[model samples]
Target chain A: MNKREELLTEKQIRRRTFIAFTFLFLFLGSAILGWQWLHRQPTDHGAIQPLRKVLDANEFIFSSLFSKKHFAKTYSKDLPLPHPRVNGKIGLNSAFDTATWKLHLVKAPGDTLLIGIDEIKALPKTEIIFDFKCIEGWSQVTHWGGVRFSDFVKKYGLDEQSKMMFAGLSTPDDEYYVGIDTKSMMHPQTILCYEMNGKPLPLNQGYPLRLIIPVKYGIKHLKRIGTISFSNYRPPDYWYERGYDYYSGL
Target chain B: MKKVIHKHPLAIRWLHWLNFPILTIMIWSGLLIYWANDVYRLGWGDRTVLKFFPGSFNKALNIPFRLAEGMSIHFVFMWLFAINGVIYFLYLVFSGEWKFIAPNRNSLKESWLVILHDLRIKRGLPPQKKYNAAQRIAYTAVIIMGLGMLLTGLAIYKPVQLNWLCAMFGGYEWARAEHFTITILLVLFFLIHIIQVIFAGWNNFRAMVTGFETENIDAKTETAMPTEPINTKSETDEQA
Candidate 1:
């Protein structure tokens, strides 16, 4: 071997080390900047709102690009019982009169309809047994029986004139609220649920009504729906405000 | 005579270093998400051998009530992670670096020998090229695990839309479990990789960063004695 091939020249080593360090410093600098960008509180959601916006944008793109007709996996009716766990109790904390409580809905500006439980039951009942996924990483195959939200919307002539972008639901005390995309709201599996496991909903299970959305995490399945409103803009969501995704889709 | 030989290419070095932080963040954020439902255990039924994590482990790490933040970070960084991985894989293919990375026909047998050598049960390591048999197998397996994580992640992320994928993995819950298991496996691979790098010494570690290593010219010429450590002096004694 030639003597020249025996070693890296002093200058060559220096140059390489300098170049490597430069790259390292550049990477570190970019990473710090990227971290700052991700943690920047651009919105009121939290310190990570900028990152949250990216996630929301992902949800938006997925929702817009994909057809909502895709059905969640449904199990055979003969399958074993599903024990639905009570995940959240934010809206269900308050005491309310079940008899006087009606589903207050806003079809359009200044157009309102107060739907009683009997009216909700009058719509064609849909019973689906599907996996109910929670954001917490657990899932249950729960059987839900109720009128499809789309059917109810159609029968009431809601969204007939103007297709709203979102469906907003709130608790009676308005402590908790969720805004769902109209497409997901009108999905065939989405229902204004009144029964669970072949029986009327227990008080803890949202009693009169709750939203049974198979295509969404349990968080979006707003319980004890007090008010239903259609909106062009995305309504404030309890969890979204608390730093969860606005879509909360499956 | 000493020779400064190219070890890792510039692109490979960059990708490797970039993946360090990216995978670290992925694992950290993944841990935050997993804390929500840390239900995995080592035993069947009620006879618990060990849990995925103890409550104290979570408390020590402050891994609580961060699901929303974790999900946001995960979804945002996942794009970067996937993109970097894709670019790295393409670079490996186009640059023909896969020759060093992909496990070949002799890898299984050689990997066992390498393992025995590592465990001090065998006298010496198997002869190697750019990467040893064990490294080739591990690196390839980690890449496959990355792909598995991506697929399983998508299945669980969009179970309804990606119903076929969910079904392929047995179900949505199974997909989540698979994803978590892969994450844990990647973590284990990372620990072992770091340990091996440390054991391999500075010349090997620096090659991953600076893309070159000083080796004895005689060592390069002698294919018969592959495992012999090159004794070569360089101008940069710090790297020696």
Candidate 2:
């Protein structure tokens, strides 16, 4: 006695159900095929081209909406890492001379500028405590003393070159590298870190100078500065070449 | 006399079916991502009853060293999951099908009886129009959980960019915990749903796919319906 009931025959129900199930199988079959196809595509810089496209699109959206006002929340200095953890030793493994370590800046294809740790420290020192998040799914509260990258750009008179699409950095041995977009580079929280806790950076934790962009995962916080360069296009990144998102924003 | 009833609309059936695979992929890929920080466990503080996942489980599932692959899949397939969910919600609202899906005041009370009946502690089912009370509650709860998954996923995904949203969910770590917990709940829901469907018998299950359910009328009832039209929807669809 239900409203909208109909007196269809058994054959009609059977026919309809058969058709419905056929369509269901077709959809599922196609879904499986699509998945296989996506994976089978040739890898483009360690990721499938389509997947990389999506990651790039994600970068576009996040960077487009990026604001300098938003800062990674600073925590109390008391909660700093008692036992610092380093996930990788790519660039830090090589023997290096801290005394001769001058940050090489390639302003253009030809123009190069050299800066020392004291020059970086001379601009202004800012102390910040924040959670340093790792892409491998762990986070620790850390205290870093550094010069705000914004001030460094201003002091070095690179205000014009700072607008480039990306700022690429490499370790002294050219092992670990990262390509950070200009917008994130100019964030108020972005700093060229020199001190960890209350003392000079430990040898393992990029002593002397390192990039500390809190707006990104720990991977983007390249340790042991060696060279810096800007380009209109995105520069090479170690993690990005291994299928990680280029933006890697927080 | 045998008769057929229009239980589900074509649109509802299509959307419902789409959700099955979409949700499966979302959960499977989510498991891949959560494997990185699989810290949740049953017992707390020193003594442990059950770990969320043992190393053996991870090995069996091939979940190790796949963070990059897991992330790429999760990020890419998220669009399909979100779009399907949004369309399903809109369709339910616009078609007035939500009436059958939404829980009523007596749902909690009746769902308990439904559970008892299924357990053989009771006899007759609560009078069901479209969905049983247990089904109403379970279905509604799942939709709410799906929405929770979306919001929590976004919060952890862009904590700095969407700081306000992340703060609303009690910050990064808490939001991740919430997201993982809801996933476990969804898995539970999926298991129970599959068991119920199989136990309900083939006739009832077929209705979902074909949009029609078969009903039987006794000879006396059939004979008494002489003055009425054979078709029910002919009048109901056009209104009284």
Candidate 3:
């Protein structure tokens, strides 16, 4: 057989190279544009806001599509631990007057109810042994006993207000706060946890009361709940301001 | 006589190169997320053999306190990764390029010979085709691994909404482990792939980039290979 001809002539090779490079340039240009667009999104304390939007969208979809009745897996018993690890120290740094600290319940702007731990304890108590997952990726199987938030909402007639889309919780000093969807807040396992491992919660673990939300990461389980507010719009979250997801659900 | 053979189709080359950077970014951002957890290890009960990463390693790499940034980048880039993979797979199916990469019945046995040849334990390679048997297996396995990453990633990302998927992989923590394990495997595959590309020389690498390769026409006939190139002119001409 005669010598085979070249698959691509010089002109063709140059043309192919030009096309390849052109496509590559186009791809790079689009990537840069995407990066700029992401950075330009509305930010919270310098954290990219588009990410927050993405998390909210994810939460909305999950809430609408999935059943709220689906509970987190309950362990037969709590894991043996001297104490759970302290993952964050943002709100725990101050010395607060525990005796005078009242749980401020906000219905709307300027409409508030100041209630004590006794008022919360007056409701029926529920106990659960469930895995507590943290955004930091560690998990602890811990026992908690408290009044379910749903029950508390019903008893206080907060459930009557149907426009409430989110529940905001804050520490006494308001140094740290979290925003939670009302649906997650009303989950069967969500509680105003005051007792842990069959005893009153230690000061390090949010002494009088903390939010125990099984459906969410530990970040949403706001400790030392000092203020509770119902809002139609999403409340500003500490972590969300710091670039973490607001939903932060499992 | 020496001749040029149309090797990788233009679309295939584009997809392959595009995946390289997209996957690199995915793995890099994944590492950033994994740094927050960094819990995997290889050992028995507490007698540690190798931690996924030691504290010193993390410090050296500055891997801590970046979870927020890592997560944001990961969530954003994931769309690109998934879309690219889906497009690539569709192209493979539609263009009939799957035949070159997908493993066949004889691939396992032939892959053994290919491996032996690679290791220099055997004298010569098995008969060369568009892709050798080992290449077919490795390429196919990588695609499957990509799918695994996507599934496991979704399972963990929305565990409650996709609880069934999470449960299918033995729950949330297990799904996370599966995702990380597959990532490590893909990284391993990437390393081996690079080494093979270097060993295979410039012509092979050029084919992936330029869509053509120089071949000895006499050798092609001696091997009794089909006259048509792996990527026929008809397929590439339209793109050209």
Error of 2 at A133 (Å): 1.6
lDDT of 1 by residue, B1-240 (tens): 346777777888888888878887888888889989999988988998989888888999999989987888888888878998999999999988898889999999999999898888988876788888988999999999988988999899889988888999999889999998998888899889889989889888877778777765464465553453343334436465
Candidate 1 C-alpha lDDT tens digits along A1-250: 1112335555666577678878887997898787777665575575276687688789877776346568999988899975789888998998899999899888777888898999999989999999999999999999999999888988888865227788899999999999888888888899999999989998888989999998899988988999899888988888888888888787
User: Interface root mean square deviation of every model, in Å?
Assistant: 4.8, 1.9, 5.1
Off by over 4 Å in 2: A1-3, A78-82, B224-240
Where's the lowest-lDDT run of ten residues in candidate 2 chain A?
A1-10
**What is the DockQ for all candidates, taken in turn?**
0.40, 0.59, 0.35
lDDT for residue B2 in candidate 3, whole number 0-100 = 40
Q: Best to worst by DockQ, what's the order?
A: 2, 1, 3
For model 3, which pairs clash? none
How many pairs of residues collide in each model? Answer: 1, 0, 0
TM value for model 1: 0.91
Predictions ranked by lDDT, top down? 2, 1, 3
For all predictions, the C-alpha RMSD in Å is 5.0, 3.0, 4.6
Better structure of 2 and 3 per lDDT? 2
Worst 10 residues of 3 chain B by lDDT: B229-238
Off by over 4 Å in 3: A1-6, A14-43, A49-63, A78-82, B45-47, B218-240
Docking level of model 3: acceptable
